[model samples]
Target: MNENSSCCTPEDSRHSGGTDVQVGEVTTTYKITGMTCGHCEGAVSSEIGEISGVSSVQAVASTGLVTVVSKAPLDEEAVRAAVDEAGYELVGQGV
Candidate 1:
């Protein structure tokens, strides 16, 4: 088997915009501050999207929620750093 198949594969169900479900993947919702428009969403998404193992990101400015899909659970510090780089604050992981 390919060494990266289990986690690094780019084939993620969340990106398809379909109902299909994928296994062994993890999703985290983060509370973000300082987003007020689509541009803010794009910035936050872009920064988080660059993190290794992250497959998809959806940031809603109105809700201040940035959901991230990845092969494995992300380190909180990494997420915080990414958000900070985008000129925002990662409040914490949501419930």
Candidate 2:
């Protein structure tokens, strides 16, 4: 499988620097609205995952929340744009 597919499996604490690097896993939860079904979840997840530095995304329609877990240096604009592109509005971001 490719590198991206490999990442989809799980989150591992392997450092390419060949050292024990403690990467800060910042999980930002975004409150979104207008998500009505599973397709909406897929769209939001895909859009956010395309942004650089965004390691993974797990979006839930019922909760109207999208949890994005990534390493340091997150682009807030990119996250917002991704949500906008998915035809949803980001109410707020925290955590």
Best-matching candidate per lDDT: 1
Instruction: Give candidate 2's total backbone clashes.
Output: 0
> Candidate 2's residue-wise lDDT over 1-95, tens digit each?
11111112322211111223347877778888876656667777777887777677777767988877677656777888878876787788844
Best by TM-score: 1
What would the per-residue lDDT of candidate 1 be over residues 53-87, giving only the tens digit for each residue? Answer: 98888887779998888889999999999888878
Q: Residue 3 in model 2: shift from native, Å? A: 34
* All candidates: TM-score: 0.78, 0.70
lDDT for residue 47 in candidate 1, whole number 0-100: 81
**Model 1, stretches more than 4 Å misplaced?**
1-21
lDDT of each: 0.74, 0.66
